[model samples]
Target: MKVLVGADIGGTKLALRTTTPDGTVRVDVEIPSTGWEAAPVDQAARWLLDRVRPVLPEDDEIAALGVGAQGCDTQEHCAHLAAAFEALGVSAAVVNDAALLVPAAGLTDGIGVIAGTGSIAVGACAEGTVLFAGGWGWVLGDEGSAPAIVREAAKAALAAHDKRRPDDGLLSELLAHYGVADAPALARAVNDTPTPATWGPAAPAVFRAAASGSASALAVIDDAATHLTALVSRLRARGAVGETVVAAGSVVLGQPLLAARLRERLGSAHPDLTLRLLDVPPVAGAVALARARYGLAGVA
Candidate 1:
Protein backbone atom coordinates (compact mmCIF):
# COMPACT_ATOMS: atom_id res chain seq x y z
CA MET A 1 0.00 0.00 0.00
CA LYS A 2 1.04 3.59 -0.58
CA VAL A 3 1.28 5.83 2.47
CA LEU A 4 1.50 9.55 3.18
CA VAL A 5 3.93 10.65 5.87
CA GLY A 6 4.02 13.88 7.80
CA ALA A 7 6.30 15.33 10.42
CA ASP A 8 6.30 18.39 12.65
CA ILE A 9 9.85 19.16 13.73
CA GLY A 10 10.11 21.63 16.57
CA GLY A 11 13.02 22.74 18.70
CA THR A 12 12.25 20.20 21.40
CA LYS A 13 10.69 17.28 19.60
CA LEU A 14 9.56 15.81 16.32
CA ALA A 15 6.10 14.27 15.87
CA LEU A 16 5.64 11.89 12.98
CA ARG A 17 2.42 10.56 11.50
CA THR A 18 1.81 8.10 8.72
CA THR A 19 -1.49 7.39 7.05
CA THR A 20 -2.87 5.74 4.00
CA PRO A 21 -4.42 7.90 1.32
CA ASP A 22 -7.81 7.35 2.92
CA GLY A 23 -6.59 8.78 6.24
CA THR A 24 -6.15 5.62 8.21
CA VAL A 25 -3.39 6.30 10.68
CA ARG A 26 -0.71 3.65 10.67
CA VAL A 27 2.02 5.05 12.84
CA ASP A 28 2.19 7.99 15.21
CA VAL A 29 5.21 8.64 17.34
CA GLU A 30 7.30 11.43 18.77
CA ILE A 31 11.03 11.62 19.36
CA PRO A 32 13.59 14.12 20.49
CA SER A 33 14.82 16.50 17.80
CA THR A 34 18.31 16.41 19.28
CA GLY A 35 20.43 15.73 16.21
CA TRP A 36 18.24 17.53 13.71
CA GLU A 37 19.66 20.59 11.97
CA ALA A 38 17.91 22.48 9.20
CA ALA A 39 20.96 23.90 7.51
CA PRO A 40 23.25 21.79 5.36
CA VAL A 41 20.10 20.35 3.87
CA ASP A 42 21.57 16.90 3.40
CA GLN A 43 22.10 16.49 7.11
CA ALA A 44 18.53 17.53 7.82
CA ALA A 45 17.22 15.07 5.29
CA ARG A 46 19.30 12.25 6.71
CA TRP A 47 18.23 13.00 10.24
CA LEU A 48 14.56 12.85 9.25
CA LEU A 49 15.00 9.71 7.19
CA ASP A 50 16.75 7.94 10.04
CA ARG A 51 13.72 8.36 12.28
CA VAL A 52 11.11 7.76 9.61
CA ARG A 53 12.54 4.55 8.22
CA PRO A 54 11.95 2.60 11.39
CA VAL A 55 8.32 3.67 11.91
CA LEU A 56 6.98 3.00 8.44
CA PRO A 57 5.52 -0.38 7.56
CA GLU A 58 7.80 -2.58 5.62
CA ASP A 59 5.33 -3.21 2.80
CA ASP A 60 4.30 0.38 2.23
CA GLU A 61 5.92 3.02 0.05
CA ILE A 62 5.79 6.72 0.80
CA ALA A 63 3.74 8.48 -1.83
CA ALA A 64 4.38 11.91 -0.41
CA LEU A 65 5.85 13.49 2.69
CA GLY A 66 5.20 16.80 4.34
CA VAL A 67 7.41 18.47 6.92
CA GLY A 68 7.00 21.52 9.17
CA ALA A 69 10.42 22.45 10.50
CA GLN A 70 11.30 24.96 13.22
CA GLY A 71 14.44 26.48 11.71
CA CYS A 72 13.15 26.64 8.14
CA ASP A 73 12.65 30.40 8.25
CA THR A 74 12.76 31.18 4.53
CA GLN A 75 11.31 29.82 1.30
CA GLU A 76 14.79 29.15 0.09
CA HIS A 77 15.56 27.15 3.20
CA CYS A 78 12.40 25.09 2.86
CA ALA A 79 13.11 24.52 -0.82
CA HIS A 80 16.60 23.39 0.00
CA LEU A 81 15.29 20.90 2.53
CA ALA A 82 12.75 19.63 0.05
CA ALA A 83 15.39 19.18 -2.62
CA ALA A 84 17.54 17.36 -0.16
CA PHE A 85 14.70 15.01 0.68
CA GLU A 86 14.08 14.44 -3.01
CA ALA A 87 17.70 13.66 -3.59
CA LEU A 88 17.41 11.03 -0.90
CA GLY A 89 14.50 9.42 -2.82
CA VAL A 90 11.67 10.87 -0.74
CA SER A 91 9.04 13.20 -2.14
CA ALA A 92 8.58 15.92 0.42
CA ALA A 93 7.13 19.38 1.00
CA VAL A 94 8.74 21.45 3.74
CA VAL A 95 7.54 24.59 5.57
CA ASN A 96 8.16 26.49 8.76
CA ASP A 97 6.61 24.75 11.75
CA ALA A 98 4.32 27.75 12.40
CA ALA A 99 2.69 27.19 9.02
CA LEU A 100 1.21 23.99 10.39
CA LEU A 101 -1.27 25.78 12.63
CA VAL A 102 -3.75 26.98 9.99
CA PRO A 103 -4.05 23.63 8.26
CA ALA A 104 -4.06 21.88 11.62
CA ALA A 105 -7.19 23.92 12.36
CA GLY A 106 -8.58 22.66 9.03
CA LEU A 107 -8.33 26.00 7.26
CA THR A 108 -6.95 26.38 3.75
CA ASP A 109 -5.80 29.93 4.31
CA GLY A 110 -5.07 31.76 7.55
CA ILE A 111 -2.33 32.90 9.89
CA GLY A 112 -0.42 30.59 12.25
CA VAL A 113 1.11 31.67 15.55
CA ILE A 114 3.35 29.46 17.68
CA ALA A 115 4.40 30.42 21.23
CA GLY A 116 6.35 27.59 22.74
CA THR A 117 10.09 27.61 23.43
CA GLY A 118 10.03 30.24 20.68
CA SER A 119 7.38 32.20 18.79
CA ILE A 120 6.67 33.04 15.17
CA ALA A 121 3.77 34.01 12.90
CA VAL A 122 3.34 32.68 9.36
CA GLY A 123 0.87 33.29 6.58
CA ALA A 124 0.71 33.41 2.84
CA CYS A 125 -0.37 36.04 0.34
CA ALA A 126 -2.81 35.55 -2.54
CA GLU A 127 -0.02 34.05 -4.59
CA GLY A 128 0.81 31.57 -1.83
CA THR A 129 4.08 33.25 -0.96
CA VAL A 130 4.69 32.61 2.72
CA LEU A 131 5.25 35.62 5.01
CA PHE A 132 6.76 35.71 8.49
CA ALA A 133 7.08 37.98 11.51
CA GLY A 134 8.78 37.79 14.90
CA GLY A 135 10.62 34.44 15.47
CA TRP A 136 13.97 36.06 16.21
CA GLY A 137 14.69 33.36 18.83
CA TRP A 138 14.70 33.71 22.61
CA VAL A 139 17.60 36.14 23.02
CA LEU A 140 16.49 38.92 20.68
CA GLY A 141 12.75 38.45 20.04
CA ASP A 142 10.17 35.63 20.04
CA GLU A 143 8.11 37.89 22.23
CA GLY A 144 5.20 35.68 23.24
CA SER A 145 7.31 32.60 23.80
CA ALA A 146 8.08 30.97 27.12
CA PRO A 147 11.78 31.76 27.23
CA ALA A 148 11.17 35.31 26.12
CA ILE A 149 8.62 35.82 28.88
CA VAL A 150 11.08 34.60 31.47
CA ARG A 151 13.84 36.73 29.96
CA GLU A 152 11.70 39.84 30.13
CA ALA A 153 10.48 39.02 33.62
CA ALA A 154 14.05 38.70 34.84
CA LYS A 155 14.93 42.04 33.30
CA ALA A 156 11.94 43.68 34.95
CA ALA A 157 12.83 42.24 38.33
CA LEU A 158 16.46 43.30 38.01
CA ALA A 159 15.45 46.80 36.95
CA ALA A 160 13.17 47.15 39.98
CA HIS A 161 15.97 46.00 42.24
CA ASP A 162 18.43 48.51 40.77
CA LYS A 163 15.91 51.32 41.32
CA ARG A 164 15.30 50.22 44.93
CA ARG A 165 11.64 49.70 44.23
CA PRO A 166 9.55 47.43 46.38
CA ASP A 167 9.49 43.83 45.34
CA ASP A 168 6.24 43.15 43.53
CA GLY A 169 6.76 39.42 44.10
CA LEU A 170 8.19 39.02 40.62
CA LEU A 171 11.72 39.33 41.92
CA SER A 172 11.05 36.95 44.76
CA GLU A 173 9.29 34.51 42.47
CA LEU A 174 12.19 34.51 40.05
CA LEU A 175 14.72 34.30 42.83
CA ALA A 176 13.00 31.27 44.34
CA HIS A 177 12.53 29.62 40.97
CA TYR A 178 16.17 30.02 40.09
CA GLY A 179 17.27 29.09 43.62
CA VAL A 180 19.16 32.31 44.05
CA ALA A 181 19.11 34.41 47.23
CA ASP A 182 19.33 37.91 45.79
CA ALA A 183 18.76 40.00 42.69
CA PRO A 184 22.40 40.06 41.61
CA ALA A 185 22.65 36.33 42.00
CA LEU A 186 19.43 35.92 40.07
CA ALA A 187 20.96 37.99 37.28
CA ARG A 188 24.01 35.79 37.28
CA ALA A 189 21.89 32.65 37.15
CA VAL A 190 19.82 33.85 34.20
CA ASN A 191 22.54 35.62 32.26
CA ASP A 192 25.24 33.03 32.67
CA THR A 193 23.37 30.36 30.73
CA PRO A 194 20.70 31.88 28.52
CA THR A 195 19.03 28.99 26.74
CA PRO A 196 15.50 27.83 26.20
CA ALA A 197 16.14 24.88 28.48
CA THR A 198 17.19 27.21 31.29
CA TRP A 199 14.81 30.09 30.69
CA GLY A 200 11.70 28.31 29.39
CA PRO A 201 11.32 26.30 32.55
CA ALA A 202 11.07 29.50 34.58
CA ALA A 203 8.19 30.94 32.58
CA PRO A 204 5.58 29.56 34.94
CA ALA A 205 7.13 31.61 37.74
CA VAL A 206 6.34 34.78 35.82
CA PHE A 207 2.73 33.78 35.41
CA ARG A 208 2.53 32.74 39.04
CA ALA A 209 3.85 36.10 40.12
CA ALA A 210 1.29 37.76 37.91
CA ALA A 211 -1.50 35.74 39.42
CA SER A 212 -0.22 36.67 42.86
CA GLY A 213 -0.52 40.38 42.03
CA SER A 214 2.85 41.30 40.65
CA ALA A 215 2.38 44.32 38.41
CA SER A 216 5.73 43.78 36.75
CA ALA A 217 4.86 40.24 35.76
CA LEU A 218 1.47 41.33 34.47
CA ALA A 219 3.12 44.04 32.41
CA VAL A 220 5.52 41.52 30.89
CA ILE A 221 2.64 39.27 29.92
CA ASP A 222 0.71 42.19 28.49
CA ASP A 223 3.73 43.23 26.47
CA ALA A 224 4.10 39.69 25.21
CA ALA A 225 0.49 39.67 24.08
CA THR A 226 0.96 42.97 22.33
CA HIS A 227 4.02 41.66 20.52
CA LEU A 228 2.11 38.54 19.45
CA THR A 229 -0.71 40.67 18.15
CA ALA A 230 1.79 42.77 16.25
CA LEU A 231 3.06 39.69 14.43
CA VAL A 232 -0.37 39.08 12.92
CA SER A 233 -0.80 42.74 12.05
CA ARG A 234 2.58 42.76 10.38
CA LEU A 235 1.59 39.75 8.31
CA ARG A 236 -1.65 41.40 7.24
CA ALA A 237 0.13 44.61 6.37
CA ARG A 238 2.37 42.63 4.05
CA GLY A 239 -0.73 41.35 2.20
CA ALA A 240 -1.16 38.00 3.92
CA VAL A 241 -4.55 36.58 3.00
CA GLY A 242 -6.24 35.21 6.05
CA GLU A 243 -9.17 36.09 8.27
CA THR A 244 -8.37 33.59 10.97
CA VAL A 245 -5.44 33.23 13.35
CA VAL A 246 -4.72 29.71 14.56
CA ALA A 247 -2.51 29.49 17.63
CA ALA A 248 -0.63 26.54 19.08
CA GLY A 249 2.52 25.59 21.03
CA SER A 250 3.07 25.14 24.75
CA VAL A 251 3.18 28.78 25.89
CA VAL A 252 -0.03 29.88 24.17
CA LEU A 253 -1.86 26.58 24.65
CA GLY A 254 -0.85 26.13 28.27
CA GLN A 255 -1.20 29.70 29.54
CA PRO A 256 -4.79 30.84 29.74
CA LEU A 257 -3.80 34.37 30.73
CA LEU A 258 -1.61 34.84 27.69
CA ALA A 259 -4.25 33.33 25.43
CA ALA A 260 -6.93 35.61 26.85
CA ARG A 261 -4.70 38.63 26.54
CA LEU A 262 -3.83 37.77 22.96
CA ARG A 263 -7.48 37.33 22.11
CA GLU A 264 -8.37 40.67 23.62
CA ARG A 265 -5.56 42.47 21.85
CA LEU A 266 -6.26 40.82 18.52
CA GLY A 267 -9.93 41.75 18.84
CA SER A 268 -9.06 45.37 19.49
CA ALA A 269 -6.49 45.58 16.71
CA HIS A 270 -7.97 43.37 13.98
CA PRO A 271 -11.66 43.05 14.58
CA ASP A 272 -12.13 41.15 11.34
CA LEU A 273 -9.80 38.33 12.30
CA THR A 274 -10.95 35.37 14.36
CA LEU A 275 -8.74 33.53 16.83
CA ARG A 276 -8.89 29.76 17.24
CA LEU A 277 -6.75 27.38 19.23
CA LEU A 278 -5.59 24.32 17.36
CA ASP A 279 -7.12 21.21 18.91
CA VAL A 280 -5.12 18.75 16.86
CA PRO A 281 -1.42 18.03 16.84
CA PRO A 282 0.32 20.08 14.16
CA VAL A 283 1.58 16.94 12.41
CA ALA A 284 -2.01 16.54 11.22
CA GLY A 285 -1.52 19.67 9.16
CA ALA A 286 1.56 18.20 7.54
CA VAL A 287 -0.43 15.10 6.69
CA ALA A 288 -3.20 17.21 5.22
CA LEU A 289 -0.72 19.19 3.18
CA ALA A 290 0.86 16.03 1.87
CA ARG A 291 -2.49 14.63 0.86
CA ALA A 292 -3.53 17.85 -0.84
CA ARG A 293 -0.24 18.35 -2.61
CA TYR A 294 -0.18 14.77 -3.85
CA GLY A 295 -3.78 14.86 -5.12
CA LEU A 296 -4.83 12.20 -2.66
CA ALA A 297 -7.41 14.14 -0.64
CA GLY A 298 -8.20 17.54 0.81
CA VAL A 299 -7.39 18.55 4.37
CA ALA A 300 -8.75 16.23 7.04
Candidate 2:
Protein backbone atom coordinates (compact mmCIF):
# COMPACT_ATOMS: atom_id res chain seq x y z
CA MET A 1 0.00 0.00 0.00
CA LYS A 2 1.16 3.51 -0.77
CA VAL A 3 0.85 6.18 1.91
CA LEU A 4 0.99 9.96 2.07
CA VAL A 5 2.81 11.58 4.96
CA GLY A 6 2.59 15.12 6.31
CA ALA A 7 4.33 16.81 9.18
CA ASP A 8 4.27 20.20 10.87
CA ILE A 9 7.53 20.88 12.64
CA GLY A 10 7.17 23.84 14.96
CA GLY A 11 9.59 25.31 17.44
CA THR A 12 8.43 23.06 20.21
CA LYS A 13 6.87 19.99 18.65
CA LEU A 14 6.47 17.96 15.49
CA ALA A 15 3.05 16.65 14.51
CA LEU A 16 3.05 13.85 11.95
CA ARG A 17 0.16 12.34 10.07
CA THR A 18 0.05 9.39 7.72
CA THR A 19 -2.85 8.63 5.44
CA THR A 20 -3.90 6.76 2.31
CA PRO A 21 -4.53 8.52 -0.98
CA ASP A 22 -8.24 8.68 -0.24
CA GLY A 23 -7.54 10.43 3.06
CA THR A 24 -7.93 7.62 5.54
CA VAL A 25 -5.66 8.32 8.46
CA ARG A 26 -3.31 5.51 9.42
CA VAL A 27 -1.09 7.14 12.01
CA ASP A 28 -1.25 10.44 13.90
CA VAL A 29 1.16 11.47 16.62
CA GLU A 30 3.11 14.45 17.96
CA ILE A 31 6.64 14.39 19.26
CA PRO A 32 8.87 16.94 20.92
CA SER A 33 11.28 18.80 18.58
CA THR A 34 13.98 18.76 21.23
CA GLY A 35 16.25 16.37 19.39
CA TRP A 36 15.54 17.71 15.94
CA GLU A 37 17.10 20.56 14.00
CA ALA A 38 15.87 21.98 10.70
CA ALA A 39 19.24 22.80 9.15
CA PRO A 40 21.85 20.65 7.48
CA VAL A 41 19.33 19.12 5.09
CA ASP A 42 20.75 15.61 5.14
CA GLN A 43 20.65 15.29 8.91
CA ALA A 44 17.22 16.85 9.15
CA ALA A 45 15.90 14.47 6.53
CA ARG A 46 17.37 11.52 8.38
CA TRP A 47 15.87 12.68 11.66
CA LEU A 48 12.43 12.89 10.09
CA LEU A 49 12.79 9.65 8.15
CA ASP A 50 13.75 7.85 11.33
CA ARG A 51 10.44 8.84 12.88
CA VAL A 52 8.41 8.23 9.71
CA ARG A 53 9.83 4.78 8.97
CA PRO A 54 8.61 3.26 12.21
CA VAL A 55 5.08 4.50 11.70
CA LEU A 56 4.72 2.77 8.35
CA PRO A 57 3.41 -0.77 8.01
CA GLU A 58 5.99 -3.22 6.64
CA ASP A 59 4.34 -3.23 3.24
CA ASP A 60 3.46 0.47 3.13
CA GLU A 61 5.62 2.93 1.24
CA ILE A 62 5.46 6.69 1.25
CA ALA A 63 4.23 7.94 -2.08
CA ALA A 64 4.50 11.62 -1.23
CA LEU A 65 5.61 13.61 1.80
CA GLY A 66 5.05 17.20 2.79
CA VAL A 67 6.54 19.21 5.62
CA GLY A 68 6.13 22.68 7.11
CA ALA A 69 9.17 23.38 9.22
CA GLN A 70 9.83 26.29 11.57
CA GLY A 71 13.39 27.04 10.52
CA CYS A 72 12.77 26.83 6.78
CA ASP A 73 13.10 30.61 6.51
CA THR A 74 13.77 30.80 2.78
CA GLN A 75 12.63 29.15 -0.42
CA GLU A 76 16.14 27.85 -1.02
CA HIS A 77 16.16 26.28 2.42
CA CYS A 78 12.80 24.65 1.81
CA ALA A 79 13.96 23.38 -1.58
CA HIS A 80 17.16 22.04 -0.07
CA LEU A 81 15.25 20.16 2.56
CA ALA A 82 12.92 18.74 -0.05
CA ALA A 83 15.88 17.69 -2.14
CA ALA A 84 17.40 15.99 0.86
CA PHE A 85 14.22 13.96 1.37
CA GLU A 86 14.13 13.11 -2.33
CA ALA A 87 17.71 11.90 -2.16
CA LEU A 88 16.54 9.54 0.60
CA GLY A 89 14.01 8.10 -1.88
CA VAL A 90 11.02 10.05 -0.65
CA SER A 91 9.41 12.69 -2.87
CA ALA A 92 8.77 15.73 -0.67
CA ALA A 93 7.56 19.30 -0.47
CA VAL A 94 8.75 21.69 2.23
CA VAL A 95 7.67 25.13 3.41
CA ASN A 96 7.93 27.41 6.40
CA ASP A 97 5.71 26.32 9.26
CA ALA A 98 3.65 29.52 9.05
CA ALA A 99 2.71 28.68 5.47
CA LEU A 100 0.63 25.77 6.76
CA LEU A 101 -2.06 27.99 8.24
CA VAL A 102 -3.68 28.81 4.89
CA PRO A 103 -4.05 25.23 3.61
CA ALA A 104 -4.98 24.07 7.08
CA ALA A 105 -7.85 26.54 6.98
CA GLY A 106 -8.75 25.15 3.53
CA LEU A 107 -7.67 28.19 1.55
CA THR A 108 -5.57 27.93 -1.59
CA ASP A 109 -3.89 31.30 -1.64
CA GLY A 110 -3.78 33.69 1.32
CA ILE A 111 -1.75 35.02 4.19
CA GLY A 112 -0.92 32.80 7.16
CA VAL A 113 -0.08 34.43 10.50
CA ILE A 114 1.30 32.73 13.58
CA ALA A 115 1.68 34.44 16.97
CA GLY A 116 2.65 31.70 19.37
CA THR A 117 6.04 31.60 21.08
CA GLY A 118 7.08 33.65 18.03
CA SER A 119 5.21 35.30 15.16
CA ILE A 120 5.40 35.53 11.36
CA ALA A 121 3.22 36.15 8.35
CA VAL A 122 3.54 34.09 5.14
CA GLY A 123 1.94 34.26 1.76
CA ALA A 124 2.54 33.34 -1.85
CA CYS A 125 2.33 35.40 -4.99
CA ALA A 126 0.19 34.54 -8.01
CA GLU A 127 3.32 33.05 -9.56
CA GLY A 128 3.84 30.82 -6.50
CA THR A 129 6.62 32.83 -4.95
CA VAL A 130 6.48 32.67 -1.16
CA LEU A 131 6.81 35.90 0.83
CA PHE A 132 7.48 36.36 4.52
CA ALA A 133 7.52 39.12 7.12
CA GLY A 134 8.43 39.39 10.79
CA GLY A 135 9.49 36.15 12.56
CA TRP A 136 12.87 37.70 13.39
CA GLY A 137 12.60 35.80 16.66
CA TRP A 138 11.47 36.66 20.20
CA VAL A 139 14.55 38.78 20.86
CA LEU A 140 14.60 41.25 17.96
CA GLY A 141 11.10 41.15 16.53
CA ASP A 142 8.14 38.75 16.46
CA GLU A 143 6.22 41.66 17.95
CA GLY A 144 2.87 39.90 18.22
CA SER A 145 4.19 36.66 19.62
CA ALA A 146 3.83 35.45 23.21
CA PRO A 147 7.37 36.24 24.25
CA ALA A 148 7.24 39.59 22.49
CA ILE A 149 4.07 40.46 24.37
CA VAL A 150 5.78 39.64 27.63
CA ARG A 151 8.91 41.48 26.54
CA GLU A 152 6.97 44.63 25.79
CA ALA A 153 4.94 44.40 28.95
CA ALA A 154 8.13 44.12 30.97
CA LYS A 155 9.57 47.18 29.28
CA ALA A 156 6.42 49.18 29.91
CA ALA A 157 6.35 48.16 33.55
CA LEU A 158 10.00 49.02 34.02
CA ALA A 159 9.57 52.40 32.35
CA ALA A 160 6.67 53.19 34.66
CA HIS A 161 8.79 52.30 37.66
CA ASP A 162 11.59 54.57 36.46
CA LYS A 163 9.14 57.43 36.12
CA ARG A 164 7.96 56.89 39.70
CA ARG A 165 4.49 56.04 38.48
CA PRO A 166 2.15 53.91 40.54
CA ASP A 167 1.86 50.20 39.79
CA ASP A 168 -0.98 49.36 37.46
CA GLY A 169 -1.01 45.62 38.20
CA LEU A 170 1.19 45.09 35.15
CA LEU A 171 4.32 45.71 37.13
CA SER A 172 3.13 43.62 40.01
CA GLU A 173 2.22 40.78 37.71
CA LEU A 174 5.65 40.75 36.15
CA LEU A 175 7.34 41.00 39.52
CA ALA A 176 5.39 38.08 40.87
CA HIS A 177 5.68 35.98 37.76
CA TYR A 178 9.43 36.43 37.64
CA GLY A 179 9.77 36.00 41.40
CA VAL A 180 11.57 39.27 41.71
CA ALA A 181 10.97 41.63 44.59
CA ASP A 182 11.52 44.98 42.89
CA ALA A 183 11.81 46.80 39.60
CA PRO A 184 15.61 46.54 39.44
CA ALA A 185 15.50 42.82 39.96
CA LEU A 186 12.74 42.51 37.41
CA ALA A 187 14.95 44.15 34.84
CA ARG A 188 17.83 41.92 35.73
CA ALA A 189 15.71 38.78 35.54
CA VAL A 190 14.30 39.63 32.12
CA ASN A 191 17.54 40.90 30.64
CA ASP A 192 19.60 37.98 31.88
CA THR A 193 17.48 35.33 30.22
CA PRO A 194 16.24 36.46 26.84
CA THR A 195 14.51 33.49 25.30
CA PRO A 196 11.05 32.41 24.21
CA ALA A 197 11.03 29.62 26.77
CA THR A 198 11.75 32.11 29.53
CA TRP A 199 9.43 34.92 28.43
CA GLY A 200 6.68 33.14 26.53
CA PRO A 201 5.55 31.18 29.57
CA ALA A 202 5.09 34.47 31.41
CA ALA A 203 2.83 35.91 28.72
CA PRO A 204 -0.32 34.81 30.50
CA ALA A 205 0.45 37.31 33.23
CA VAL A 206 0.22 40.12 30.70
CA PHE A 207 -3.26 39.05 29.72
CA ARG A 208 -4.18 38.61 33.35
CA ALA A 209 -3.08 42.15 34.09
CA ALA A 210 -5.07 43.35 31.11
CA ALA A 211 -8.14 41.54 32.37
CA SER A 212 -7.62 43.32 35.67
CA GLY A 213 -7.70 46.66 33.82
CA SER A 214 -4.04 47.50 33.56
CA ALA A 215 -3.55 50.27 31.03
CA SER A 216 -0.01 49.15 30.30
CA ALA A 217 -1.06 45.61 29.62
CA LEU A 218 -3.82 46.79 27.31
CA ALA A 219 -1.32 48.97 25.48
CA VAL A 220 0.98 46.02 25.01
CA ILE A 221 -1.83 44.01 23.46
CA ASP A 222 -2.81 46.91 21.24
CA ASP A 223 0.76 47.22 19.99
CA ALA A 224 0.86 43.50 19.35
CA ALA A 225 -2.23 43.74 17.17
CA THR A 226 -0.74 46.59 15.25
CA HIS A 227 2.48 44.69 14.65
CA LEU A 228 0.60 41.63 13.50
CA THR A 229 -1.50 43.69 11.15
CA ALA A 230 1.62 45.30 9.78
CA LEU A 231 2.97 41.89 8.89
CA VAL A 232 -0.06 41.25 6.63
CA SER A 233 0.21 44.67 5.09
CA ARG A 234 3.86 44.11 4.29
CA LEU A 235 3.09 40.82 2.59
CA ARG A 236 0.32 42.38 0.57
CA ALA A 237 2.58 45.18 -0.62
CA ARG A 238 5.13 42.58 -1.68
CA GLY A 239 2.57 41.10 -4.14
CA ALA A 240 1.19 38.32 -2.01
CA VAL A 241 -2.13 37.07 -3.35
CA GLY A 242 -5.50 36.33 -1.79
CA GLU A 243 -7.73 38.40 0.46
CA THR A 244 -8.05 36.08 3.43
CA VAL A 245 -5.62 35.94 6.35
CA VAL A 246 -5.63 32.70 8.33
CA ALA A 247 -4.29 33.12 11.84
CA ALA A 248 -3.28 30.49 14.40
CA GLY A 249 -0.82 29.83 17.26
CA SER A 250 -1.07 29.69 21.02
CA VAL A 251 -1.33 33.41 21.87
CA VAL A 252 -3.74 34.37 19.12
CA LEU A 253 -5.89 31.25 19.38
CA GLY A 254 -5.97 31.04 23.16
CA GLN A 255 -6.55 34.72 23.93
CA PRO A 256 -9.88 36.00 22.68
CA LEU A 257 -8.83 39.54 23.52
CA LEU A 258 -5.82 39.43 21.21
CA ALA A 259 -7.87 37.73 18.52
CA ALA A 260 -10.59 40.34 18.76
CA ARG A 261 -8.09 43.17 18.71
CA LEU A 262 -6.29 41.68 15.72
CA ARG A 263 -9.54 41.13 13.87
CA GLU A 264 -10.64 44.68 14.46
CA ARG A 265 -7.30 46.12 13.41
CA LEU A 266 -7.04 44.00 10.29
CA GLY A 267 -10.57 44.94 9.30
CA SER A 268 -9.86 48.61 9.74
CA ALA A 269 -6.52 48.55 7.97
CA HIS A 270 -7.41 46.21 5.12
CA PRO A 271 -11.11 46.35 4.49
CA ASP A 272 -10.72 44.04 1.51
CA LEU A 273 -9.15 41.30 3.60
CA THR A 274 -10.98 38.74 5.68
CA LEU A 275 -9.41 37.36 8.85
CA ARG A 276 -10.15 33.76 9.71
CA LEU A 277 -8.88 31.81 12.69
CA LEU A 278 -7.66 28.34 11.82
CA ASP A 279 -9.73 25.62 13.50
CA VAL A 280 -7.63 22.66 12.37
CA PRO A 281 -4.11 21.80 13.38
CA PRO A 282 -1.52 23.07 10.88
CA VAL A 283 -0.39 19.52 10.14
CA ALA A 284 -3.61 19.29 8.14
CA GLY A 285 -2.12 21.80 5.73
CA ALA A 286 0.90 19.60 5.27
CA VAL A 287 -1.44 16.75 4.47
CA ALA A 288 -3.31 18.90 2.02
CA LEU A 289 -0.06 19.77 0.31
CA ALA A 290 0.90 16.12 0.17
CA ARG A 291 -2.43 15.23 -1.35
CA ALA A 292 -1.97 17.89 -3.98
CA ARG A 293 1.57 16.81 -4.76
CA TYR A 294 0.49 13.20 -5.26
CA GLY A 295 -2.47 14.21 -7.47
CA LEU A 296 -4.86 12.70 -4.99
CA ALA A 297 -6.95 15.81 -4.21
CA GLY A 298 -7.01 19.59 -4.48
CA VAL A 299 -6.73 22.05 -1.60
CA ALA A 300 -8.28 25.27 -2.81
lDDT (tens digit, per residue) of candidate 1 on 1-300: 899999999989999999998889999999999977898899999999899889898998888999999999999899999999999988999999999888888888999999998999999999999999988888889999999999899899999999999999999999999999999899899889878999999999999999999999999999999999999999999999989999999999999999999999999999999999988999999998789768876534
| Per-model TM against the reference | 0.97, 0.96
TM-score of 2: 0.96
Which portions of model 2 show Cα errors greater than 4 Å?
none
Pairs that clash in candidate 1? none
lDDT of 1 at 131: 97
TM-score between candidate 1 and the true structure: 0.97
Give the number of the best model, judged by TM-score. 1
Candidate 1's displacement at residue 8, Å, is 0.4
Q: Tens-digit lDDT track for model 2 on 271-297? A: 999999999999999998888878876
Candidate 1, residue 221: lDDT: 98
Q: Give the range of the ten consecutive residues with the poorest summed lDDT in model 1.
A: 291-300
